[model samples]
Target: MAKKSSVFICGNCTYQTSQWIGKCPECEEWNTFEEQLQGKTPTSNHLAIKQLEKERPKLLDEIDINQEIRTSTGINEFDRVLGGGLVKGSLILVGGEPGIGKSTLLTKVLGNLSQRDVENRVLYISGEESTSQIASRMRRLGIENNQNMFIYHEKDLENIFAEIKIIKPKFLVVDSIQTTLSPELQSAPGTISQVREVTFEIMNLSKNQGITSFIIGHITKEGAIAGPKILEHMVDTVIYFEGDQNGYYRLLRGIKNRFGDSNEVGIFEMTGAGLMEVSNPSEYFLDDHENEGHGRCTTCILEGTRPLFVEIQALVVENKFGNSRRTTQGFDNNRLSMLIAVIEKYFGISLSFFDVYVNVAGGMKLLSRESDLCIIAAVLSSYFNKSLDSRTVWIGEVGLTGEVRSTPRMDIRLRSIQQLSYKKIITSKKNLESKEILVNNLAVNNISELKNIFD
Candidate 1:
């Protein structure tokens, strides 16, 4: 006999309570608690205990080290973000806003995989779309129907598992984890218990069968995965696909990875043909139109191992209202305010009544501290109504005392700038003295030195 009881679970963090509450104590999210029926099955517990009994602990030295095998998806940008290539038995969760090209990118990867080996079995299980609809998208992505690639439109977890057992696919893609349901659970498909159980089962399948799996997930209004936070923790890698709906570019960022470096980003352009990789992201992000302005400046930030040069644009205007507005896109608002205060304190610039707006070109977010100097330069240029040299690149972190600090991997940043044939590099004096690279370098120890550069 199974014992069943009603429980309240937080949708955001999967926090469980005996009764419903207005807000979740774990995640601090309001109105996220949902009532659900939880059942305890003794059979599952027995199975788990039996499974654990079959495994024995061994010494670390006793284990044999084998070379890691990685299969390329035939996309360089995608492979770079996946840490060289796709690792077998790895579970990957891909989350994004609707229509952000999560399905399209994976479809293209599957198409490429199908082309590589006609015998390799790849299974795509879609709970949201019909088989014909997926085929239509495959044709749009120029994927021809092949015997190796199979699509099964089903939402039942048992049926999906049955298909997987029959096919024994080397690779598996679940279009979405939310719509798949287990008959054993009384709650809806996207509930906390359902999602957690499904993910746990999928992980077990991947690890036991050595099948690489990619699970597509939907994001919430808060820009996080819609299901419980525990869903992200169970996967081997988590990737977020980001871009503006109206924009032509899309960015694939790796948020967590067990086999590769996290925070790796893959740049792509969404076109009629499909998602095309932007090889030279620096050249792609920096356009000539962005350079023909007073408030615009160039800066380089490393994305994973690749150095990308991006343009920072700032605008300063008189604030008719009492409270000056500070607006920014792809840049931190708090950092912008701090930089504005630094400019006012160090340079004695009266920008208290001016509204400041800063933007990082190409819809790319600037997370590195190295872009601090470039942001300051852009702000000052806009305030003074004087344009800085477009050929000059800024690379340094700004301190509270208005002193420039050296950033990490200064040598790599300098070499990248030099390769692009930039005329002058402005960085901390420490970086210039430490590196012997022969490039026209401008050493700036303090923020006040910037006042004389544009003059």
Candidate 2:
């Protein structure tokens, strides 16, 4: 028998060392190293290599192009984030904070897949919860009639694989990868070594067996998947649930996808039944009945291919004490500061002495630069205590010189605004020159012109 060796690994980046270090040189993270006992390496198999030698590499033209078959999870919003639908033999990793509806959403997905084909078998393996607990939750989700769905409560990797080999389910859901342990390793579950090994085995199983698999993962406090970075690289797609657990809305954002666009987003509302898709996210996000007041404005942004209208609100208050603070939610603080400088320089508004607060309604994070104009409008409205047209939408990016810049997909944004029956739009003059629009267009070349709109 070969003697076992011990090695230290970084939990964050999976950097390995013979000796434990206080800080990891690879990821620059401190105190993330954990020790693991490694077993003896297995001898190489000459027969397997001889079998591989029989296959020859082929040219790209030699490969046949066929339309990939996609199985819908019976959730439109989930399918949207998945680039249309789940592809066969694909390994998907879903990560989120605890109690953020990761299991609920995936449970619903299993139920949906089971209902699609009575002959097909779908399995749900849980490491954290009991089968009865999951069944009760499924009942609450109104998924009581899934005859083809099977649930197993097991954490041992060997037993799980044994069952997978016996059942040979078309779709598989692992409630979580952290709690699933490999008996071959001495490291505890959720450790870097165990996580990497478990994911590797599952990936091979999915690819070799043509099984569609979903693995639920826990996220760290820093809002990243709680495993080695290689865990994400090993999967076909990575999706994250974004929103406060207490909040009613959740946004599923695709981080990586090999088969489809990775920028796609899916919106869901947590309800008594389960996660219900929000068909019209624009209508759900915009508050139509609220009185138009200072510090509030509307803007349109594109998430993947979908256009959404979001409300931007700002509050400016005179700071009596220490330093003026700039606070924001769902908007970048550095960008807000730059926009404020532009407003003060071009509009001649002194906001340095005032504390500024900006927020995006409906808990939606604004990544698009097109919301810059709406944010500026909101801040100016709040500072001057004036209200702009409630039916108007602002869309444009602000340059350092205070020029309103054009944004991509302006036509799609305009059409969405018109669909919502918005009365007016304030954007760059360049965006208005080529097309005929139904609503009123308030085109401006510089931030100076925004003062006239506020007045």
Candidate 3:
């Protein structure tokens, strides 16, 4: 006989407590705790222990290393984000907001794989959609169904596993993990416990059977993957499909990867046909150059192995109200405030009574700290009612003392900019001193030196 009791679990962080509380201690989220009936704990560790006992540990030198096996989904952008391609026996999780093209992208990948692989054994199990709905989408995506690609509409974890065993699929995709539930678990499908257990079972299956699995997940209102934080930790790779619903461009960012680089990103554009890969993201982000007027400047950022050139625009208006508003889009708000303060302190430009607004073009978020110089230049150009040279590019980190510091991968960044045929590159003097740099470079030691160049 086993004991059962009631427990309160936080949906955001999986913090379990005997009593319900207003706030979660781990995540500090309010009203996220849900009461659920706890079932008897399973003594399954004995089996795992016995299985581990049979395996022998080998020295690093003794183990033979083979070429990592990868299956390209035929979507170059998707494959690039998956670190060259999908690895054998890897469990991948994809999360995004509704209508962000998570399903469309994966469906296209499956379709491509079906066409490429002669013995395509890809099973797409959907818990939320009916077979008809999926078929309709496949038609819209121009995916002609193959004999090997199977679709099953089921939500029961056991039933899904049974189908997997029978189909013996080389690749599996669960439309979503939240909708799948086990019969034995008393909790609802999307509960923390249910999500955690369901994911663990699927993970075990993928590892043991050497089947690659892609699990779709929903994000909470907080923009994090729904369910417990532990769910993200258990997967081999975690990818977030992000884009502005109104915009056609989409970014697939890999936040975690056990086998490859974690910061890899793939760019895509939504079209009538399907999710199309944007091979030249630079052209997409910097398509417009006619509006090189005051408050606009160009900058380069490194996204994984690729360097991207994007325009930064700023607007500084005299504030009518007592409190001036500081707004930023695709740029950090705190970083903007810091830049404004640096300008006021060092350059003697008082932005206290001016409303400052900054935006990074193309709906792309600016994550690089090196974008500081470009931002400052844009702000100054807007404040002084002057425009920077259209052919100039800014690259440097701004410190508190208004000194321009060298950024990492300076050589790589400069090479990318030079390839674009930019007339002048502005950065710290150290960059110009490097003999490897082969570009027309402008050296600026501090904010004062930077202002003099434009003046």
Candidate 4:
């Protein structure tokens, strides 16, 4: 009797579909199509009651702001990612693989907050762990359980909200969002729809209730935060706790930060108990290679706004067989090929008959173009069996024409070098023109001049 009802669908990157088709326009997953009841009426989400509540925000000029109210998490690296400190009414989403220390990091933050003498009680809602499992971790950590830190073992979203009302805690945490379910939806827990609904409600609560909430989200096989992409979009801040489980070190990257700069990342090491902060990263990167030779050199890489000194090792040997091998770790391979091409074309090194292997000393990956100058310098130094001065630094972008290009944040980079007590830097002439750039010594804008000095 009624006209055919239209089916609800995923318009972008659709993992699910409404009907079978030759090509899937959403998400490009051709056959991953599942249909649900199309005619069901959508219900008003009671999960997000906090957002539905009435509040009138005053104009900025009319309200007096407290600059000191932004709270620090007691971890310098974590605070850096959060852009100074935690803001009230901000929602943060953290995701990683199982046994990756996502829960451990959050627990550490909560432990510190529990020690504080504030009216705000930290509510840790653990939907995954039982009371006994949580107890074991606390015992291993050698930290006493907090009387003010309230723990819950519930998974129902409605009940979780009810507990929020009863406790009226200032800070809230959901150990994981996937385990929790809402009563309004007929779909099973962990469904795309349910995940989206639950997170939406939680984010709304943080804004309306003035509660800073931390939500631990599950990761997909692709290593991205699971559930709808919207789950990440809805939150004020999104961070990923990532590392090699077999390795000792861990990395935290801020993918989306509404309050602060997003490029910042924190590095930590996992101990027998919990994660210990890496106060001195340079020491961790340095290996036992005290003996130096022609093929080895030291390089400084710029991570975000911070500069870290690292060692680069290169090996060159004659290849007897055809198809010479060129391998590199931490440094990109294609970029190495480009550099080799430059060496052959510009310097006439004839590397096509040899095997070259390059590696950055630690288990770190270099992402920026600032490492270009150092990498090329190392390759050339090894090929010619020559060594560059260890006390100096080289930083510049390598153009296709084999010319060094100027990099951004030169002044900031110089300040980092000063802290490390480096004496000299070899860079492009464009950067030396700025009077504000004050370094200990200047070796600027003369790539040709630098080689001539060594000659």
Candidate with maximal TM-score: 1
Flag regions of model 4 displaced more than 4 Å. 1-16, 20-42, 50-52, 56-68, 288-290, 435-455
What lDDT does each candidate get? 0.87, 0.88, 0.86, 0.75
lDDT score, candidate 4, position 116:
79
Order of models, best TM-score first: 1, 3, 2, 4
Task: Estimate the lDDT of model 2.
Answer: 0.88
Instruction: Give the TM-scores of the predictions, in the order they appear.
Output: 0.94, 0.93, 0.94, 0.88
lDDT of 4 by residue, 76-128 (tens): 88888788888999999999999989888887787787777668588889889
Clashes of 2: 0
Which candidate would rank higher by lDDT, 1 or 4? 1
Misplaced by over 4 Å in model 1 are: 1-5, 27-29, 42-53, 289-291
Instruction: Give the alpha carbon lDDT tens digit for every residue of 317-423 in model 3.
Output: 99978699999999999999999999898888789999999999899898879899999999999998898887788888899999998877777777777787888
List ranges where model 3 is wrong by over 4 Å: 1-4, 26-31, 42-62
By lDDT, the better pick of 2 and 4 is 2
lDDT of 2 by residue, 1-455 (tens): 97878999898788899999999999999988888887643233221121223447899999998899998888999999998899999999999989889999998898888887886788999999999999999899888877888899999987898888788899999979999987766778998877987887888778767889999999988899998889999999999999988889999999999989887899999998888999888878886725878899998898888888888999999998858999999999999999999998998778878999999989999987999989999998999899877789899999999999998888898887888788999999998888889999889999898676677
Q: What is candidate 1's lDDT per residue for 73-159, written digit by digit as tens?
A: 999999988998999999999999999899999999988888789667899999999999999999998888587889999988778
Per-residue error (Å), model 3, residue 200: 0.5
Question: What CA root-mean-square deviation does each model show from the true structure?
Answer: 2.5, 2.8, 2.6, 3.6
